[model samples]
Target: MNADHADDSLLICRTLGGCPDATRARATGLDADGMDFAVAVAGIEVPVRIPFARRISERAEIRQEVVRMYEQACDALGVPPRSAERNSRSRPGLK
Candidate 1:
């Protein structure tokens, strides 16, 4: 389910602060939902769509599992611990 703007502020900030190669922040205007803010991430308008607690829990579980798997793989392959997180996110279905 979608979230109220207040509950999704941190997420919005993070999304805005992500690796935007070079894009102007334009006040394009309200979307169908009348949101006051929006961004075109990698060419898609991803406004705040915070999931319910259950979904958040499930995502956390998936993240932990992925981190564990990546850590194990890194240890087995003797890669650095600092780099496992990147690999974890790169794994399919983790995002």
Candidate 2:
């Protein structure tokens, strides 16, 4: 990831709890409008593009958008948001 996309990438990873799937996922590209993820589905690395509803010009908007996306994904999967306690517990050496 480049400097321009580092923050957004971090936000996306954290909100999604690393990745939605375990198949060698990565934030391959990002722009002011959207992001591209390289994920392996069925042993094939596919490029998935997620576009923003509106152009995001500032870094502050990243968190909100990531959270919204994460929540939507969780709802779609019929799972609850990963709680702070669970997150902390799951991470090694975290208190």
Candidate 3:
């Protein structure tokens, strides 16, 4: 994959990794506009697509946009953010 695609993939993975109920969710697609995720619900796997509030023009904005989407999803599901542990553990020198 190209550099931009790889970076976007990582951002998507990190974002979804922070979602508590996304164990069964898989990213299906991504673009400058938004991303698509396949999530399991009610014994069925459905696509959950989230578009950014505005077009993202730079790679630096991907993380923020992804985080925003994650927070929005968590709010909609009435769950707390799940990335705290993951983020801490992924750090270079944190315990």
Candidate 4:
């Protein structure tokens, strides 16, 4: 992901861990291969599968790359981490 998307991406992942408010998603790494991650809630394991890269690019330069990736996963699952969707889709302006 580019620098501009870094913030959104990171926000997405961090928010996904709100289900039990204990476990957090962790990223292993990324490269030409697919994504690698783990779900540990309250220090326990949660079933999860991370999506790998589809294209070639340099690794994330930011320090929060892993968190961003996790948030992306949460978004895919339609669950924003720490999410409330205040001005979300159902909001008047969204439609």
Candidate 5:
């Protein structure tokens, strides 16, 4: 696998915590490989809100606009947005 594929596999494994070779397995329809690819394309939406002094007010509006745009694009592509789990089990201080 190429670097990008490896990265996606790593992310899939990290997030889903399934069989290590599941991502490498062949995709026979909507299986692990297909789901990995889809998730790589349309990842879980984690809303980010950064506070900057100059554009504080504008940032909120821009953030909403961008989120709306992303939702519209996902709708057009027929892929649903994956919501983040309330409890993340990943190591703290890690991205």
Candidate 6:
């Protein structure tokens, strides 16, 4: 299911804001049935595709699935997940 432009703003903002290296206010223009946004990860601009969905429930489900898929892809690529990195840095007694 493809989501229209109006439906995905919150997810976009949240996703962008969560990363320290993200472009902050930059998002690529829409193409086809999806839109691309870039976030700086490990000093690299990583493009994330946001798909369209017709309803909020579908969007919610899509968000969960997308997160799961992204984690899997990171594992396959031998890249660390963002949360792991963030948490590692935040704990006081661990260097």
lDDT of 5 at 42: 34
Error of model 6, residue 9, in angstroms: 16
lDDT tens digits, residue span 11-84, model 1? 32233324233122222332222223344456666443222223223434644433443354345444455453
Residue 2, candidate 4: C-alpha displacement in angstroms: 18
Greater-lDDT candidate between 1 and 5: 1
What TM-score would candidate 4 get against the native? Answer: 0.34
Off by over 4 Å in 1: 1-57, 83-95
True-structure RMSD, every candidate:
12.6, 6.7, 7.8, 8.8, 15.7, 10.1
Question: Which pairs of residues collide in candidate 3?
Answer: none
Output the worst ten-in-a-row residue range by lDDT, candidate 4: 86-95
2 against 4, candidate with superior lDDT:
2
lDDT of each: 0.34, 0.54, 0.54, 0.44, 0.32, 0.44
Q: Candidates' TM-scores?
A: 0.26, 0.60, 0.51, 0.34, 0.28, 0.33
What is the full ranking by TM-score, best candidate first? 2, 3, 4, 6, 5, 1
Off by over 4 Å in 3: 1-23, 76-95
Model 1 is weakest, by summed lDDT over 10 consecutive residues, at 4-13
Top of the candidates by TM-score: 2
Candidate 6 lowest-lDDT run of ten: 1-10
Per-residue accuracy of model 4 over 12-85 as CA lDDT, tens digit each: 33443333342344444555544444545566665443344344355653334445555465556666553466
Count of backbone clashes, every candidate in sequence: 0, 0, 0, 11, 0, 4
User: For residues 1-95, what per-residue lDDT tens digits would candidate 6 score against the true structure?
Assistant: 12432212323433423443343323565443444665445666666666543223444565554455445544544556657677563322111
Model 3 over residues 10-49: C-alpha lDDT tens digits? 3333344343333355567778998776655445666766
